[model samples]
Target: MGGNLQAEPGGIASFSISVRNTGNTVAQHKLTCASGHGWPVELGPSQSSTIDFEPLDILEFLPMQVRLRIPPVTNGSPPAGEVDMITCTVTSSNDPTFSHSEYANVTVSELKVFSTELFDLQGNPVGPEASALPITVETGETVNVSMSITNIGNIEIPLSVKLQSANTDWGMYLVYDGVIEYDRVTFNLLPGHSTTVQVTAIIPLSTFDGSQNAFSLTTRLDEVGTNQFITNGTNFLVGKLLGLSLESSGEKVQATVGAWSQYSLWLNNTGNGALNLNWSTAEPPPGWQFGIDSAPKSIDKLVSSEVSFGVIAPNLAAVGDIEQSIRVRVIGTYYNDSVEVFIDLELTVVPTLHFGLELAPETSVHDLPRETQGQIVVIINNLGNSPGGGNLSAIIVDGEGVEDPEWSLQYEHSFDELQPGEEISVIISVTPTADAGSGLRTVEITILGQADEGVIVTTSEVLSLGVTAESSTTAFDLSSIVSTEVFFSIVVLIPIILFVVVRRMRSSAKIYDDEGESLVAPGVHTSQENISERRAAALMEDVEKEDDVISGDISQFEIQAALVQSIGDLPPPGPAPLPTGLPPAGLPPVVLPPAVMPPAAAFSSSPATTAQDITVNIDDNAAQGGVIGSEQSSSEPMPEAGQQNVAIAGMPPVPPTGLPPGWSLEQWRHYGAEWLQRHSGK
Candidate 1:
């Protein structure tokens, strides 16, 4: 009989058996085998060989062995059983009637096992027991650990793979066949087959440097009523990677000239450790100023910081925007590694223009004469931050609140291209007419400046001027004493006063005799010494006649001087010296009889009279008779009957032939007597 046999699945099961010839007679037989489980059965070592048995031999026993192979589990394989039988048959090759058979029992057994290992991405082994090895990684970095799983058992099984991390900050994942699974996966594995599953670990940026993390990968049966089988794990350490990020609050900045501008900046530390940051600038525009609030600051890992800076433009800066750059550096305090970043900045400037006027204290108020000129000096200033130019002018007004036509105003300064805080001096000239009286006056000066964008700015100032007189001292002014009309009338009245005084003194004079008896004649003037009483009446009539010669050329003083010279030459009138007393007193005593008067018949009939014609002979005693005449001398010549000759001494000569045409003959004969008459009248 075959002994009972047992075998594992997918392995060999063997048994030994003997077969005798049951048929009588020496017949040839074939030896064959059959299995209950439908397993492959071998009759001998050679599958095609047959065993011969002696036909009915007396007590002969032939030994034969059968081999059975356990079929691997498959979709078409029969169900496994606790026990199975294998039968061996001996049959006659020549006679089919004589055959014999024998059987053996077989049993099936299943075995399951698996192994695991860890490798790097390059397929190199990590360590003897991959769980004890440590891996280095930076923050925010992803690393893969290759895990190899092999099934060493005699059966195919489904498995569940899982990845786990020791630290919660690390992210774990499992990848198979290019598909990622979060920390766990399920798949099937056949016996004696190998596969690779990727275990990935991700480090967070917030993780600190030098931090440690442990990663575990485990595999187990996926079937029901099975426990986990294999486990693999690894360790990771956080490394230092220095990083920096710099950002500005705004990209553009606006500013004015000579003014300050401000902006904000933010610095972020992206490294796994702390860092020291330093900030600086490149070359800027000339005369520009910079101000920073915080510099060279320290920042922790994953932390951000904010700072502010200021910039001031120059006073003479241009009116447009400019570009500049700034740099920030991260000094690695952990690993001595550095990083740098540069940022571009923009600047803008604006223009402003303002003006002012400054007046000197002395020029603000002044005293001026009407004829003299006055001047005022002032300072013009630019008070803003731009370069500009404009116009300048002046206006004047008097105390009566009206523009004074007599007052003139002028400014000799022209303003152009003035810089900020620049100053210029201006002179204002003031002039007044002669008729501008003493009063107060005002002068207003104005300055205009052109600002940016065609805007105008103006400033003005006013000054006072006091008018005064030309002379300073008090004195008599002859030039102003009288007007021209009054002076000419005083010169014309001085000549008429002298002529009336001389005429009254000549009319009160008289002629006297030696005994105080006035020389007298009957009805005749006594002042005539050279003419008889008979010619005095004719001289008085001639002196009264109107003549042209005496009115025009002759003066009264010349006529009076001639009369005085002619009268002084005559002797004063007196009785002739008594003829010798007793003129023929003896002869008169002898015969004193009255002498007889000559009768009127004895005179001839002629009107002409002379000294000789009127003479009568009188004896020495003729005074007793009332007759007075002298004896005519014999040597005296006689005059014609109608003519007479008269002569006078010390008189103006006349025409010798006759009287003047306007004069009568009677007046010519007595021309010498007119001087005597006028002298006696005065």
Candidate 2:
């Protein structure tokens, strides 16, 4: 064991011992130590103790640290630095008393790496750790610090020390103790040597951090590196540090170009002493102005203060990031060293949006007409601001029973952008069916949104409409039908077609002359022979009165009336229809007088021949007597004194002769025989 230790009275010194197993086999050994103090010896400064080693691998060294404590001198105590023999014995576990002994030449000395004095720059003594150090100063102040380092080894060692600080302005240097030469130097001293050196460290200002980090001083020996004889450390931070920070500096501020804004800044002095700091703003945007809210002079340590500022952006500040900074610098010559704090003022510029969206109708409520479409105008106003663009559309509010295809709505409007206070108009057209009953109709108009405009559509509102039912008619409700072409084809066109067909059919029928040759009908020549042959053919056709009434033929009725008079004057068959205006064949109609003249008077020479020629007239006067009345005269000539005649049925008898001045005597017998025989069915 090799160690040189120092101890004060009633103190202890420590040393280490290495036990190497040189044998090839693994062995177990028991370690024991004995000293001449005649007390229990141990590896840890005890007078007597047992140290059992575990199984030792081959060629491995099992090292143990042993300590020696020296008691104060008594009547029988050894003097200081007197040699004490500490014999450490190791015995193999397999052999009894098979032991080996090693001796430790221990001096009764306390741990004394340095026995010199240490002083600070103010001539005050300093301690050995981060606890006791040179006095602290305020921020931005350079501090003078001095300390000494001693070489505790017997051989000479190279010495160097550095101040560990991140501050660029902090300075530190050292010099050999008790020498006027202040330049840095290293010396190799003789054995059992000791030397003193002085050191200086400059503390930086901005170090009042809560992360438990501070500027420190460490020493280094050239030969032994940083271990062994170079284990000197000192913490330069005293009670607190000078620090300044703005609480609101971490977040960004938003504004538009040409707009002014204000911000509240909080400054905190987290140090233990009074502080003096000077701050300024730098790199502001062009044409912009900046001002402090409430600037104070200084701050006491550990105290927090508040400050406010206003920044007015220029009318030409570009729309992007504006790089700016706030610098807080401090210098202290009293308690804490110098500090410099910087916070960036990142100004983000954007466009101001003050647009307004609304949907207003021309009227509050719309009253729609039945069976027709209605329209309303909606006003869309662009109460604009800086700049933005959006779209506007209309939405119909769905009401109960309003889901029919007959009810419809339509509209679409879009404005890319508008000037300040610009106005726009839109129209919403609504259509209702004919069957739309009396009720209310609701529609909603809304402003639609475009992509990335940041405009929410809150302009939806309902538009109500009152409707009325249609009038009652025999017409059918064809609202569910596709069209009205089918109704016109059946109701109107077919009736017109039937009237044309009946008029054409009546014009094609033949009409006969049957007014006993006095009144001639149409479709006859003026020749009497042609008239007689046509008349005979018309009579032989057997005209029926039912045919006249059913076929709506007026000329057919005249034919039936003439056949009735041929039997006898039977009151002209109850007024047969006479063709008026133009005839059905487009001929001029013939008009007859109220009486018929006695025919053949001019044609026959005697009254008997005229009486035989007397025939019933096919006119209204034929219903009269021989003198234009219904009665027949008795003093009448027979049909040429021997001709046979048949009397008509439903006829009155003839009157006696000597009738009137205009009477024919033989005409009475003609009427009697014909009227009686026709009535008797002969």
Best by TM-score: 1
| TM-scores for every candidate against the unseen true structure | 0.26, 0.22
- Error (Å) of candidate 1 at residue 464 is 99
Error of 2 at 231 (Å): 9.9
lDDT by residue for model 2 (235-266), tens: 44434445565667666665443334667677
How many residue pairs clash in all the candidates, one count each?
1, 51
All predictions: root-mean-square deviation over Cα?
48.1, 36.5
lDDT tens per residue, model 1, 268-342: 776556776666766666777776676646788768787676776665455666656444333445546777765
lDDT, model 1, position 578? 24
Q: Could you give me the TM-score of model 1 versus the true structure?
A: 0.26
Model 2, residue 262: distance off in Å is 16
Top model number, lDDT: 1
lDDT of each: 0.57, 0.49
